[model samples]
Target: MSPIEALDFVGVALFAATGALAASRKQLDVIGFLFLAAVTGIGGGTARDLMLGVPVFWVERPAHVLACAATAVLVYFTAHLLESRYRLLLWLDAMALAAYGVFGAYKGLAVTGSATVAVVMGVLTGTLGGIIRDVVAREPSVLLRQEIYVAAAALGAATFLLLDRAGLPLWVTAGGGFAAALILRGGTIRYG
Candidate 1:
């Protein structure tokens, strides 16, 4: 698979773990784990795909769904081993958010060819799933502009676009963007 596609799938699994963590926190059943995992894994990409006038990714590749389900099951069975499960969830979310931000901006550049829209799409791709997850899980939405969640995504997306425009290699741009996002979100998760 291409690097972008791999990044997307990695986000799927990591976000699935985040979803499963949420379900575990709520003391939900296996079904809840499955439901939340699938939703959180694909929610942002599905929305971005729709807006981009493309097919939803998970529909085109059922393996993504399977990955989500498997991650949920793994979390269900193994979450108790972690010292602080919520911290794991936050860190995992940061990683996935960064990867998804780069992937989304790259996809947006390929699709819309507009740096502005690409950045917006990247932000949406990174944050929409968590927003939906929080809403469904009955938690406060992170998009209340109260934190650096979306800002980190925006920074990552913008970083990618700028690097691309500067003629940097795609992988380098992706890496830079990912690091930008992870560092930004990680700082907040650690301090806030």
Candidate 2:
């Protein structure tokens, strides 16, 4: 698969895993798991697309939904076999947050060709999914946490925009943004 496609798939799987974990924590059934996964995986992209007046990525490419559904199924069954669901959930969330931040920034840059717009879109894309997940689960959203959740996304987005402005290659900017977000979020999960 193309690199972009591969990134999207990974992001979808990670987001779906987090969603499934949330559903499982709530004792939700298979359908609920799938629903949560789908929402969490696509919520950010959908919001970004709507704001940009572009067609939603998942609507145009059904593979995104399929990938999330598959992840939901896998996570639903496998979650019972794993202990420390909380730790699993936090790590999966960090992965998804980083992946989405990178991909979203890339998409935003590609769409608007403006560094400012890209940064805003990146933040929107990274955080909206978790917001939707928390709302659906009727839990306090992570965005509201005193921990550095939104701050991490914002930092990653700004890093991507600045790197692009500095004439860095797309891959470099994307990878750096992803790494920054991952490190920051992981730190928060570990010590926050």
Candidate 3:
């Protein structure tokens, strides 16, 4: 797979894991885990594709759904072992936010050649899944929390666009976005 596709896969898997962790907190059954996993994994990308008038990603590639299901099952059996699933979820979410932010921006720029669309898409792709997960789990939404969550996403997305526009290589742009997001989100997790 190309680097972008691989990062997208990683983002999906990480989000799915976070969804399953949320389910575990609620003492949900395997089916519930699967449900949350699928939604959290694909929701953002699905929204992005719809808004972009492109084919829904998981619908076109069933493997994305399968990856989510597999993550759900794995987390179902293993979530109990984690002493702090919420902490793990936060870290995984940070990673996912970063990956999805860059991937979404790249996709938007590629499709529409519009930096505005790219940044917006990146924010949506990074934040929508966790928002949906929190809403479904009846947990306090991360976006609603007084943390730097959405700002981190916007920073990463805009960073990717700016660096790419500066004629940086893909590695630099993607890595810069990812690092920018993780640093901001990580500070939130550490300080709050």
Best-fitting candidate, scored by TM-score: 3
lDDT of 3 at 65: 99
Clashes of each: 0, 0, 0
TM-score of 2: 0.93
Task: List, residue by residue over 1-192, the lDDT tens digit for candidate 3.
Answer: 777777799999999999999999999999999999999999999999999999999999899999999999999999999999999999999999999988999999999999999999999999999999999999999987845888888899999998999998888888898899889988889987
lDDT of each: 0.89, 0.83, 0.93
Clashing pairs in 1: none
Clashing pairs in 3: none
In lDDT terms, which candidate is top? Answer: 3
lDDT of 3 at 142: 93
User: Worst lDDT window (10 residues) for model 2?
Assistant: 1-10
Give the distance in Å from residue 2's predicted Cα in candidate 1 to where it truly belongs.
3.2
What 10-residue stretch in candidate 3 is worst by lDDT? Answer: 144-153
Would you estimate the TM-scores of all the predictions?
0.96, 0.93, 0.97
Candidate 2 regions exceeding 4 Å error are: 1-4
Residue-wise C-alpha lDDT for candidate 2, range 1-192, written one tens digit per residue: 754456667777888888889999999999999999999988888888898888988899998999899988998889899888878988888877777777777788888888778877877888888889999999788887745877777778888777878998767877788889888999978887
**Candidate 1 to native Cα RMSD, angstroms:** 1.2
